[model samples]
Target chain A: MESLLSYAFMQRALLAGFLISITCAILGVFLVLRRDAMIGHGLAHVTFGGVALGLFLYLTPLLVALGVAVFSALGILKLKERAGLYGDTAIGIISSLGMALGIILVSLAGSFNVDLFGYLFGNILAIDPEEVWMALILALVVLITIVLFYQEFVFLTFDPESARTSGVQVRRLDKLMAILTAVTVVLGMKVVGILLVSALLVMPAAAALQVARSFKEALMISASVAGISAIAGLVIAFYFDWPASGTIVAVSGLFFLVLFQARSYRKPAQEELNERV
Target chain B: MSTNSSLIHVDNVSFNFHGLKVLQDISFSISPGDFLALIGPNGSGKTTLIRIILGILKPSSGRIVLMGEEVHQFTQWQRIGYVPQKATLLDPYFPASVREVVAMGLISLKRFPRLLTRQDESSIDKALDRVGLKGLKSRRIGELSGGQQQRVFIARAIVNGPDVLFLDEPTAGVDADTQARFYDMLAELNRKEGLTIVLITHDFGIITKHANKVACLNQRLFFHGTHEEFCSSQAVQDLLRGEHHLVCHRH
Candidate 1:
């Protein structure tokens, strides 16, 4: 276990895991509160088009993926506001369109040296130095944005009309949050892949919320839980020779189940207290 | 605060939803320090009118002016505060303290990323005190009673020190005593701080008692005037009294 730290790839993978966990955990709180989990999932799938397009065009996959994801997020926002479509409907349409486009593009570009399964299911061992740096930069951007607009985001999530009346520039803030979610989704695809990225973004936050006393505390605890799950999953996967992304998602799922059971146990006591009061 | 004349001016405003007329040729002006109660039955377009005033909805036919400027051109929302009809739509279990919720009112005033300042803190405290929830500032919102929760939302509205405040069915679901208290708080705020208030409510008795002006709405502008004028107007009296008779006869 100690010798694993000596290998550059292993170190890169660990660092990437830490950054991904932190980013996803923070983003998860807003996504879950705003009920935008499906949007994150949709954006993750939309990122596949970016990935395929990059491969076809011989450009950087991360940049193209980010661009496509951002565009999809913007598109969803526009359709919801201007076109009067419900948000979930917009996300559903975009997700299917993106996936169809990706499939067609991949098929058209035959003989390309791309592993479709790796992009779909993720391969944590592929975290090179360049990818690690990219993850770090994306995580930093997300963290700073969250800190900067913490109060605004909280207000908007709870009540958009009140936020707007209070002069929060709600539309602008909504756009910013959507774009940030897109960035996080694109980056998250590298670790959890499009198929399960929202799990990483949502599960730990949901679990942390079960025990937290306040929003701030929930965010902190969720980040810690996410980071722990990533590290533990990586170690377990390495030792047991299991699939990295699958093990990570499973670990997170187990944590959620445990938290759910704990909450259920406490419910009766809380109800008793309520009756006594 | 700007001592501008005619705080809100509605000029021949009309609204349609899917080509069905909702408000037709509605015109009214609310000056600073005015407390106006918008009384109406269900589907009377009260919410629509409020939304139009807040710039959330556009008038189909005419223009609205606020503080001598076109309403559409007004960009500074810090001057206005709004409490929605169903604050209950927010999840009760959301992890937010009363103070934290009130601080959200200051989101527009603060430059991004900065912590709350002394001024913001004092104003929030004052707003909470005004709403009679100063002692429960640390309490989580989920733990509060319905009336108390509404007061917290009111605190959030006033935290920005807004000049104009709009509340839709603020006393809904609250007990009679709590509703009276809520109105008293609004009255005190209007009298002492001179906050312009536009309240949408189904409670006509309270409106007749406390409101300086009243607007009876049902799709179009039924009537708009001072309380005395509204009570004297045959159309307005018929609307309210007819509804009252229907309820009494049903029971």
Candidate 2:
């Protein structure tokens, strides 16, 4: 492991992996609780169009993807609010449009580049040193925003009407959360690829929720589960020459399964205890 | 007519949803410490009216004055406590302690970078104690029974000590005994603690026994007056005589 860490590429991969995992974990908790878990998946499809546009324009695809994903996230929310479209319905429209745009852009480019596949299936070991710094910055912004508005977010999720009545500025915070989700989805592409980015944002949180007694505990447990999975996936992928993104998601899936099983067994005992009391 | 004594002043408010009129020319004022029971039949826009007053939904026409300020311009939201339909929107598996759920009421009172201080903790404790759920402070909110969950939301609403409280169908799922106790607690809050209340409920018993004011609505403000006046109103008398149900018969 030490020898593996000595490699510059491994170091960048591991750092980016851990940062992105923790970021996704925290944001994922909010999304899952708000029943918007599919937003990450929808935004990732939009990110594909952004990436294709960047590649065609000879610009930084990651930056373009970030811009496109954020706008699309906001658009999805607006359509849901103003047009009164259902959440999944809004997501479906935006995601399909994004995919169509990406298809057109790739066709206009005249050839499918090898680099596109690299993004479709993440090449985390090939992650640049600059991308590692970008991950760190993204994680910091997300962390700070959550810390500042943790109470408001929880309240909004629990009961939006009460939150709005209490003057929580629910709409503004919603846009902020969307932007952050967009950024997280874009950065997550580096770890899990566009095809699987939403997995990072979903599995760990769902796993944590299985046994968590409180919201704070859920957040902590989710972050720990995600962080450990990222590191473990990296080590396993390195030794077995497996795909890193798939390995990481699979590890988190394993965590969810174990927790789910444990919960199922414990529930009957808990019911019996309640009966006795 | 004086806005100074009124906690909420709803003036000619109208709302249209999907091109259907939900409320029309509704006008009422809730004075300080008044226990106003907003009674109506199902789909009579009772919830819609509450949402409009809370600024959760905008009226198509007319104005709402909250605490002498126009509703949209009023930013002192901590002074208003609202308990939405009891546990209707709440996820049964939501992971939050009783303390955490109650503390949510105080979030609006805080500024940016809001952190729960020691004072906030004691306020939560007091709110829980008032609702008789202080012993379950550390328990998961989802673990509580339906009645207990209702009390938790009430605690959350009152944790910040708002001057006026609005409850929408708060007794929908609870047992009759719990509903009675709930009204008693609300009456105590109105009489002793001086908290103004606008309760949306179906129980006529609550209106006669506890509520000081009654607003009978069905797409319009059919009646808005004291309980005695409501008891004697022709529409109410007809209803009580089984001419109709809760919806006041428009002449």
Best by DockQ: 2
Off by over 4 Å in 1: A111-114, A265-277, B1-4, B245-251
Query: What is candidate 2's lDDT per residue for B143-163, written digit by digit as tens?
Result: 776677888899999999899
Query: lDDT of candidate 2 vs native?
Result: 0.89
lDDT score, candidate 2, position A24: 97
Model 2 clashing residue pairs (backbone): none
lDDT of 2 by residue, A80-146 (tens): 9999999999999999999889999999889667878877888889999888888889888988899
Compared with the true structure, what per-residue lDDT tens digits does model 1 show for residues B1-251? 23257788888889999989999988888888888999887888999999888888888988888777787788666778889997855577687878889988887677757479988889989988888778777766776777788889998888878888899999888899888888988888888899999999888766766788888888778788877787677786576564662211100
Give the per-residue Cα lDDT of candidate 1 at A212.
Answer: 62
Here the TM-score of candidate 2's chain B is 0.95
Listing candidates in order, what is each one's chain A TM-score? 0.94, 0.96
Interface RMSD of 1: 3.6
User: Under the 3 Å rule for N, CA and C atoms, how many clashes does model 2 have?
Assistant: 0
State the lDDT at A204 in candidate 2.
Answer: 95
Per model, kept true contacts as a fraction are: 0.54, 0.77
